[model samples]
Target: MAKYLDSNKVYRALAFIDPYGMTVNWESIQALKGLGIDFWILVPTGLGVSRLLKNDGNISEAWQRKLEKFLGLDRQYIIDYFYQRRSVSTLFGEETQINKEKDIVTKIGNLYTERLKTVFEYVSESFVMKNSTNSIMYHFMMATNNHSGLKIANDVIKPKYKL
Candidate 1:
């Protein structure tokens, strides 16, 4: 679809609504950036981080394998790299500190922040959408630079609840 859009010169910008932002190819994204194509990514931030951390039934193993196949890296290597990059060591002193052990929210927020930093150059904007209630949705926008693209995304793909 990106190739088609590039060949036909059809799209002005591309918005990727990725659940985890793990499957994305940064090289391809960089190439698209070279072509002057704008991007907005709606990355899952809060609950998704908790889910990944909990990994109750080896579900994360499946995701790990999938990511390994996509990124062509060892699962353990990926885990180590992501953890090292996203570690809140300064905030909590050492890895085994009591404060770090208890504050899952801060840990997850730092993880998401680190992930965002990795792609800071490629994307014009990113958003984190949290489930406000069982039915309602709330969005927190980040890295917002492309005003027009953000406007388009808010208008077209904003979630609707069946209330």
Candidate 2:
């Protein structure tokens, strides 16, 4: 789809909204950003973060294979994804160990927030939407090139998804 947009010369500042932000390739995202394509990514917070960290006893071999493929890495990267230090080290230059579930949730949120800041010129926390079944509110990040696009996204799109 990015290739199609590029071929047709469509550069009117588009947005890609997705729940699986972790699965997205940052390199491809950078290429699309060069073409004025912004990204609104949903960060799985609360229980979702715990599930991902623990693998939830539901991750099958097939699911692991799919995750590996999505992340474009081998098994070691998958291990690192689950076991790596989850902290605000990049921003604060100090690593705080995450030992509890609440700490893990906070760390995941901080990590993604930092990632959005690192990748985009303008980043905003659009809103949080609650999951009906689990009753967990997941945070969303809106990454854009300029303030106008961020305004449009926050004023228009953000309200629609507000819980």
> By lDDT, who's the top model here?
2
Stretches of model 1 off by over 4 angstroms after superposition: 1-33, 47-50, 55-60, 67-74, 81-126, 133-163
lDDT of 2 by residue, 1-163 (tens): 6566544545555565564535555455556543455677776656454454553334567655654544344655545545544556567697745333335555555655665666577877546555677454566777876678788767754565334
Report the Cα lDDT for candidate 2.
0.57
How many steric overlaps does candidate 1 have?
0
For all candidates in order, the CA lDDT equals 0.43, 0.57
In angstroms, the error of model 1 at 124 is: 5.3
TM-score of each: 0.40, 0.53
TM-score, cand. 2: 0.53
